[model samples]
Target chain A: MRSLAILDSTLREGEQFIKTFFTLEQRVMIVRLLDRLGVTFIEVPSPVSSPETREAIEAICALNLRSHVVAHVRCVEADVQAALDTGVYGLNLFFGTSNELRSYSHGRKIEQIAHDAVPLIRRIREAGRYVRFSAEDAFRSDLVDLLTVFDAVVDAGVERIGLPDTVGIATPRQVDRLVSLIANRYPNVGIEFHGHNDTGCAIANTISAFEAGADCLDVTVMGIGERNGIASLSGIISQLYIHYPDLLAAYDLTQLVELDQYVADCLNINIPYNMPITAPSAFTHRAGVHTKAVLRNPHAYEILNPTDFGVVRHVDVGSRFTGRYAVGHRAVSLGLQLTSEEIAQLTQALKERAERGSLNDEEVNTFILAWYEEKGSLVWER
Target chain B: MRSLAILDSTLREGEQFIKTFFTLEQRVMIVRLLDRLGVTFIEVPSPVSSPETREAIEAICALNLRSHVVAHVRCVEADVQAALDTGVYGLNLFFGTSNELRSYSHGRKIEQIAHDAVPLIRRIREAGRYVRFSAEDAFRSDLVDLLTVFDAVVDAGVERIGLPDTVGIATPRQVDRLVSLIANRYPNVGIEFHGHNDTGCAIANTISAFEAGADCLDVTVMGIGERNGIASLSGIISQLYIHYPDLLAAYDLTQLVELDQYVADCLNINIPYNMPITAPSAFTHRAGVHTKAVLRNPHAYEILNPTDFGVVRHVDVGSRFTGRYAVGHRAVSLGLQLTSEEIAQLTQALKERAERGSLNDEEVNTFILAWYEEKGSLVWER
Candidate 1:
């Protein structure tokens, strides 16, 4: 496992979804947050889009952060020049290469695309900036043609080559095989994998690409990007930390939820309640079987403690799945105690309320206290 | 392309996320909606879980629809008995088979699992119910052992074998290769792919599995299930409909957004505004360039028209990217004729308001009308 490399694309892809375009100051704050979170790269906007976008990129570039700032651009001379004008540390030059794009969308020959991309990549590198030449639809492109395009860009002095499943079509095995095949053939070429969530395979494909010898991963905060979006930065970071701890350095994982919420607020979008890691319910337990185990040892049901990410654990008593153990634990936390028989009676009442789908935490506590009173074992003064 | 067989797990998996558990009535409504939408299978809950669940499954089984009502059950004789008592049209028999599950969770040997599964499968077959055998964590299990477990279940009269990436570890290529390998070797056995969204590969893996000859694809409404959830029913349906229209038939695609919203409301979960297809912004354009193309031809920026999914195309004039095309389109819609200069002026005002992040639809229209009045274009008599 290699140390995880987080590339924050909030400015580039996340801005695409905002009803209101971000100002220079807002872009500066986002870059600061990315820096605070110790992200490896902060992807700014395509400088060719607008003067405002270019200003925002320049503002981000002015920030004194350890993280590198990169600008996205189409694989053309003007776009490359626009990106260069922002003074970004690195450049991501992308273009459509698949048949769907070449024949149906761009109506350009594959050779023409290579010709347009290679010289621009050489110019960017000659200017002393890092360059990652990307094939926009590499997954759907012919293997021979993809190799030829990458070879041309790499020979033209591009430091890295990125293969993007621009349409979210590639599978993990295909990523692994393609990345490995390319890496093996071109020993000096650095590889980066850019994936999308159109088919929800982004993260899996990214990891497989890493295993296949890719040096870096392209990700976005909350997976905000085109269509169904890309692999989530938080999801990938947490997984890498937990499963491949040896390969990656420690990230400011505790800041993840806060970062997500900030972005959500900025974009005026609601993060789904069940979104992994950041979701309110992700750490909560209500099922009877799960609750029992969780009450015994939270590790039984939780992959990691909620507090690890500075989130609170919620004991939800909203259904028949809510167990006696959870109820008893909550009562104990409230400094109450009950005998076995009283606890069992309280459990039965709770179950009945839950069965009706109307149970709440207060109701469950009320029933527990009433049971304790009836059994003459009430520990509270009241 | 093969016709995609959608196995809707709304009842079995979707119910897991709700704080307010579904009543028998709500379950029936969901089943009816799914049936009307022409899903191939509707997975009802385990009868052993509750009397209400059993009642719901029985009621759905009695419905006169093309969809088969399949009851999900643990691979145990008692669970099978409960399922049989409900008279469900089909059985989804599932069990854990990975070393982690066998050693740490269930403490059962692989041989014991095969032994236990075989008799239950045979009994279900003897009872004349269509049985789908699933090896939980099949993705992590050794290939030989997994094959052994699947072979035994298949030979014991199981109608289909479900290969689940229980931990969401399989890539699309892995899914394709595994399913194709199984299909090639076990020509008589039907293959079903059950995927999770842990690493967010569920949809791609499902499609790959389909291409690899899998007979059924397991999905949940809004992708609700354990952890990060399962493959999204709406997403899979839309992908199949758009990309492989000849593969399936009779689905009322327009009902998709309505059905998804209905389920989200019942589950008390807010649908993310960025959710594909059903999201508010999915068809709404704020970018100047996109709005221009949309005004001339909506298909220029979108593959499927909004009306096709029971949604209206919205031109949101609340971004620096909002241009004259959006203003002109709105003016035309309101039966107003404005000069190019007036449209440009209004567009500039909208962009300014958008820059401040305070723009609204009414304000945009107000500004446009005011601009028309100033230019002597307003005809109040009409």
Candidate 2:
């Protein structure tokens, strides 16, 4: 279970997020952050596309971060050469294998694909570099065709294989079954799983893959990638830390929010409100009943403690849904003591104001202080 | 499998979204939209919180939509009376049963809670209104404690029992086990599931509950709730439509996008980029390799068709990753024929330009026409 390694592909797959264009400086910063965060591998764009892409890869590699840098390239010979020229630690070679891709993408049959990959695999290995041969749409590809390619690549000296749910078509059950099949067949080889979130199952599918014995999982920060992105790094961490802490022992868990903030700022996209642990409201208790309970004991309503990720808990006390208990707690915190009746009245006043919209802390405090004065509670001071 | 019912809590749970303050008119509009979308039940805020909450409930009930309107209230008699006064078709009574909530929230032990709920259940039943007794933190409650409370409520004439993963602490396996246990024990009772998305498993857990024989599942538009929201209505729909289309045949599936857009606009929040099926990027395919295959067969990259949801597919063709095939296809569509070598050169130029950032359609067309003219491609006219 602890064998799973993280391959942070934020620089590679995240570049595919709609309208995302990371500068060379942004790429270096992201790679440095991810490396310091202790991901095992950092997958970056290949040099095949442009001179700047190659420069970005070369700059990342030159940083000599703790993480091993890898490049994602197609199976074409020119791509392989460009990857080698980057002086990276490893190369991930991918090809379209599903029937739809086979018939239309490269227009290559299974035999032709397998035959073409052997020499590339041999060349990458001969250069004393790490290599992984991946089938682009492994889940949609025929099982026989996938195995044939896997077996051929292994014979040609490749030891790692990637199974990608390229179209995000896989369910968790399917992910588990496919991963277990690959694990059993390639007992000596490492299996990697890459999934997309088209149906909102990417995180679950990645979990299922790990549970079924995949050794590596692909993730992008905030799950940013093409078409709704892939499994999010923080989301995976949130799920695993609670159930499988040992797998993440090497990572600095507290830096999760910092990473999310940095990436969101760099990309100029707001951290989504529903982001698992780092969203502003992830730890906010708003409903009257929930605020009341969470005020009494955070455990009453919270399972993921905000403190674990360097975030503070916020109990909203200025809404129509704000309960008397939350208001009373706020009153006490502000150095005031109110009777039960006063507390109820204050809560009612706040709720009415909130019915029109939300109120800030200052307004809530003002209402409480005015209520105290109106009730003669501040008569001694006057 | 088709026994599952949708209890859309957009008005009830969605109100807990941070800063959400739906006016009476907004609440009525949302209720109308949901009713038109064909949810079996529409759950709304209880009247006990404020006069306006009750007014909102009354206004929705007055609409008399085809779906039943249920008010969510505490098990307290005053709350029950407030819900009853609203003239809602049903009442949902909830009590926190977990040790954390029992001690910190209501300070009632199992027997005390059971003793208190009997009269409220009896009163609701005597009023001839549909009533559901729910355990607020059912997932965290001791199994015996949960069964004890559930049994007491059933004995008190409550026909429906809700199992809420209140803190979002449940896994898929746990949801299945808990649902199966209650399902087997109380075959005559209705089982409803309300899950949260803290660990990003709300939809998965809800689906697991359904698979384990739950009769109903609670959802909010965009999964908006207190903290990271609940299971999204669209996420659940995306999962079910693929596996249980018969269950959702009654719904106007095309209205899903409209509903999401309306709610997002009302709340002034962007629909998250990863929102299942409705996000702008949900059907947008980028990546040169992906565009090529998607052009051949959309199924190669898309499992859910955009047409089904009144959306169109967008093939991103102006990125650094643009392939020659995608560019050449665009050239042909624009009535220009270029040699393979020229297409490759043009693709390279586009990639180089894209390294600075993304290009608009006009920019791409300008580059293509310039290249055609530069290559002296007026041969057809000559």
TM-scores of the candidates in the order shown: 0.84, 0.96
User: Across residues B155-254, which tens digit of lDDT does each residue of candidate 2 receive?
Assistant: 8888789999988878777888999989999988899999988887788788889989888899999889988888888888888877788898788888
Model 1 / residue A39 / CA error / Å: 2.3
- lDDT per residue, candidate 1, B1-382, as tens digits? 4556789987877666644477877878888888778888999878766666677677877776788888888887898999988768889988767765565445678888889999888888888889998887777777888888887887898888999886666667778888888898788878899886655567778877888899899998788765567788766765675567776567887777877888888877666543557766566665455566556666544554567678887766666656677778788877897788777777776666665664678877777677677656444554
User: Can you tell me the DockQ of model 2?
Assistant: 0.73
Q: Who wins the TM-score comparison?
A: 2
Model 2, span A1-382: residue lDDT tens: 4587899999889988885788988888888888878898999888877888898888988999999898998888999998998779999999888898888789999999889999999999999999999999998899999999999998898868999998887887788899999899888889899999887778878888988888889999999998878989987888887778888888877788888899999878788776788888889899888998898889888887788788999998988889999999999999998889878888888888888788878888887887777768566657
lDDT of all predictions: 0.73, 0.87
Interface RMSD to the true structure, each candidate: 3.9, 1.1
> Which CAPRI level is candidate 2?
medium
Error of 1 at A323 (Å): 4.8
Fnat scores for every prediction? 0.13, 0.69
